[model samples]
Every structure is written in structure tokens, then in C-alpha cells.
Target: MGTTARETDRERHDEVPVLEAFTRFLGLQRGLSPHTVRAYVTDVGQLLEHLGGDEDADPLARLDLTTLRAWLADQRRRGMSRATLARRTAAVRTFCTWAHRSGHLAQDVGARLRSPRPNRHLPTVLAVDDAAQLLAVAQDRAGDDDPVHLRDWAALELLYATGVRISELVGVDVPDLDAGERTVRVTGKGDKDRVVPFGVPARRALEAWLERGRPALAGPASARALFLGARGGRVDPRTIRGVVHRLTAVAGVPDLAPHGLRHSAATHLLAGGSDLRTVQEVLGHSSLATTQRYTHVTPERLLAAYTQAHPRA
Candidate 1:
């Protein structure tokens, strides 16, 4: 009895060993976040499934520019977004390079693969007055001294004050704060650490949370966590996002997630005369190019600068 073509294909495309090795490389060597490692592994798994091997050949050995293009085309046909396509292209290239270096393939076939540029849209940011109004609303809500309200208020304040990602913010521990200096030490992407300063308002909010709020919610599971869920475990990112959305709706401002607060902070910092390099450091962005996106100035500011500096204006 002969095997069916589908069974043969499945046998030739065994991805377990390759995926496990690549997972280790991505996590241990590349130091990618768990989420990122999962994404890369998923992309590579899809690629291998798309290009099954011959009877005696390794599946990855079949990887080539033509097959890579065909895979991307199939993804496009399935209505994948441009951003997803670009990320998958990058994943395949990285995987091929690793495969070659690890002796799984003769060469990095995906080295020549190119990704379509993803659309670049400016992030949503609040106006200065709107931000102040939003904070004021949050402050008013926290006046009741409710533990959850205090935590939410402090979280919002710290988010805008430091422009840290929601993940970084939730990952904060009690010891990460330098109360005297009004700074918080955050772990950013790729596990890089940086210290960012907060304003007096944020400091007051944090103090209230630490002194009055956290104690009320502390439990055996709380440990050193800076924020706690209703059940006293470390706060989740989705919870923080919910807090932002609910507060924004009550504040009558633009409905914003936590990242919107970050965008607003970065924009306000640039508008307030902070240098790009300083903003880059404050935000813990690995590249100055990422920080440069916040440099877009309002027409009023541009005109003011032109009028102030232009000789003929």
C-alpha cells in the first residue's frame, strides 16, 4: 500500500525540531519578547507548511525566493494586512539567516526577500487643554479615596507623565519608584531598562496610591506589584487599557487607550522645547527615527517659529 500525497507531504514537512530550535534562538540569542518570539515562530511554521520538502530533503532546504514570494502572495490573497505581510517577510528572512548559520540550509534563501512598506499614520494625541481636562477629571474621581479609583488615577497620571508602554507600566514594582526624584525605572522592549521622570501631579497621585490605596488592596499574591487587580494579583495590560477607555469616556475627551496618553506625552514634550534626543531617551526608543515621528508640529507653532526666525516675516 502506497501513502497518499497529503500523508507524504505531512511526513516531509515535520516542523517540530526546526521550530523548537528556532524558538530557542529567538528567545535566548535574539532576546525577543515572548509575544514576538511566538509571532516569528508562527510565521516560520506557516512558511514551512507552505513549502513541503521532498522525500529525502529537509523542509527548510526547499526555501527559496520563488517559494517565499508565492507564500506572501497566498497571504495577500487571504486578506492579510500590509503590516502583517511586512512582519511575516521579516520573520522569514530572520528564520532563513538562522537556518543557514545553523546548517539547516546551504544558504539564506530569504536574504533577498523584501517587504512592502507599511502605511505610516501619525499617532493620535490630545491637545494640551484636553489633556489637562482629562487629568482633572481623573483627579476629581479619585477624591473619594476609593482604592480602585486611586490606582486608576495614579496609573493614568504615570502613563502620561512618563510615556511608558502599558506593558512596562504594569510590570512596575513598588521598589522601581524613586519618590524623592519623581522618577520610575521601567523595563522596555527587549528587556532594556530606563529611568523616566514624572511631574508633581503624578507624584502626588502615586503617593496617594502607595500610602492609602495599595495597602487596602494588598494580599498574599500582591507582593511588590505596583498595581493590583480587583482580586489582588498583578494588573494586566487589558485592565489598564479598560481604565483608560472608561476614564476618557467620562472625561469627555477623545476616547483614547493608554498608548494615546504616551503619544500625547511625547508630542507635548517636543512642543514644550525638549530636544529629540531627550525625548528618545525618555521614551526608551532604541532608534531616534521612532522618536522623530513626534516632531510633527501644529500649524500655529510652525507659523510662530517662522515669524520669529524668518527675516522677511
Candidate 2:
């Protein structure tokens, strides 16, 4: 009739192992990236901590819609952004589904959970002429003698040319590039690899860096890294961002992040008549819907181009 000491000990012992098991399942079974798996574990860990990790109350047995909503509300009250709440909501939903499939729960309580949609903000991008002028200036600064300048030029060209994320850009190595074909093999999210091509300008910049620039900067730690920092180590994303910001300011445009170049590349591609699916593959977007955002940036440019060129008016 009464609660026993052995039952309480057993309940306490169950909580940690289940969470650890779920983590292993995420990495080994689901093939989730380390970053994504860590996020899921953190999201669920916070909820479990919120539920007080009761020794007598199992998380799977006690979890339900009400408690889930209460946790979300608490996070909101603590000033978590709607976007974060939405992400956490998705994470929990995924965890619940996984738990159900693993037989930890009799039902999927998160099937009906909901969170506020994050506002869709259009990405900042440069106009076509601004992008050209910025690169031109970078090219001028990249005069043959300076390895840093050469590296900067190649980085800027490759970024705008291929639209790879800063992380992917930094991760590139000498072996990744195909010189004659002018393509680079990039490993994107979930460790998926794809070959992306660049045009003549990017190829030339890369050649200059690889031939003249990289050799000058190469040190013990360089190890075939495509980009290098001041100390001859692999370049970091922050250094890349600083380069973009400084270049844009000199180009007489608003200081922009490296990602703004990516946005510019996507927008320019669409304005130049690239189809959506083609753009999607070039951007390495997993969803066609995610790639559709660039379509919004193209209509005004299209109308402007049409108005100037068409005789129908």
C-alpha cells in the first residue's frame, strides 16, 4: 500500500540511462549530425530538468500535453524567442516520437503539440552592381605580392561564386578542388557531399591563391588548408566575416556578413533565369521550400528588367 525504498531507487536509476540511450540512438541509429543530436538532447534535458527529475515519477509515464505546454510557457515567460520555442517544440515532438517507437512510451503525447511560427525575415543582399564593384576592389587589393590579399580575394570570389556557407568554405582543402573542371567538392549538413562548380573568375582567384598565396602562408599547421589565418593556421569563420564586413564597407555598401554574399549569389542566380530546382541544388538546400525564399527577391528585379527591355510598353 505504501511507497517502498527499492522502488524509489529503481526510478532514480532509470532516468539517466534512458536519456543516454536516446542520445546513442540519435547518433548511431538516426545518423543525425553531432550538432543536431546535441540540440535534441539539450532541449529534452531542459524539459526533464524542469519536470524535476522525480525519482518516483518516470518522464515517459508523466509527460503529456499539459506539462509540455507549461514548459513552453515557462520558457516564453523567461523571454525565449518564438523561433527558439518553435525549435524546442520540434525537438520535443521528435523525442516523443522516438520514445514511442522505442517502447519507452505507450503513446506519442507530442503529436498535438504546437508552437508559434517564427517570423520570416528576408535576407540582406547586395545589388548586382554593388557585388561586382566589391569584387573588383578586392581584386585590385589582391595584387600579386601579398599572400593575405591573394587569400582574401580567393575567399571572396569562392564565397560569391559557389554560395557555400562560411563553415564549408573554411573546411575546403587543396584536394577538394578539381582544377580543369573548376568544381569543388563541399561537404554540407549531415555530412553530405556535393560537387559545386565555379566560373572562370573564381577559378583564376583560386589558382592565384593556391599557386602564389598559399605557399607563402603555409606553415606547420596549414596542412593543405585552402584558407589561412595570420599565424598560418586554417582561417576561421570569424576572420571570414571580418573580411566580408571590411570589404563591403570599402565598396560603399552597408557592412554585410558572409552570408549576405550567399544571399546575393542566390538572388543573382534567380534574376539571371536560373530555375528553382537548379538554384536549390547549388545552394545545397534540403527543401525546395527553403530555396523558394530567393524567389521573393527576384520579382522586382524582373519587373525592372522587363520594363527597360520590352517594347510592349
Best by TM-score: 1
- Cα deviation of 312 in candidate 1 (Å)? 4.7
Residue lDDT tens for model 2, 130-167: 99889998898998559989999999999999988888
Off by over 4 Å in 2: 1-20, 53-56, 300-313
The residue ranges of model 1 lying beyond 4 angstroms of the native Cα positions read 1-13, 52-57, 310-313
Which ten contiguous residues of candidate 2 have the minimum total lDDT? 293-302
User: If scored against the real structure, what TM-score would every candidate get?
Assistant: 0.90, 0.83
Model 1 lDDT on a 0 to 1 scale: 0.89
Best of the candidates, lDDT: 1
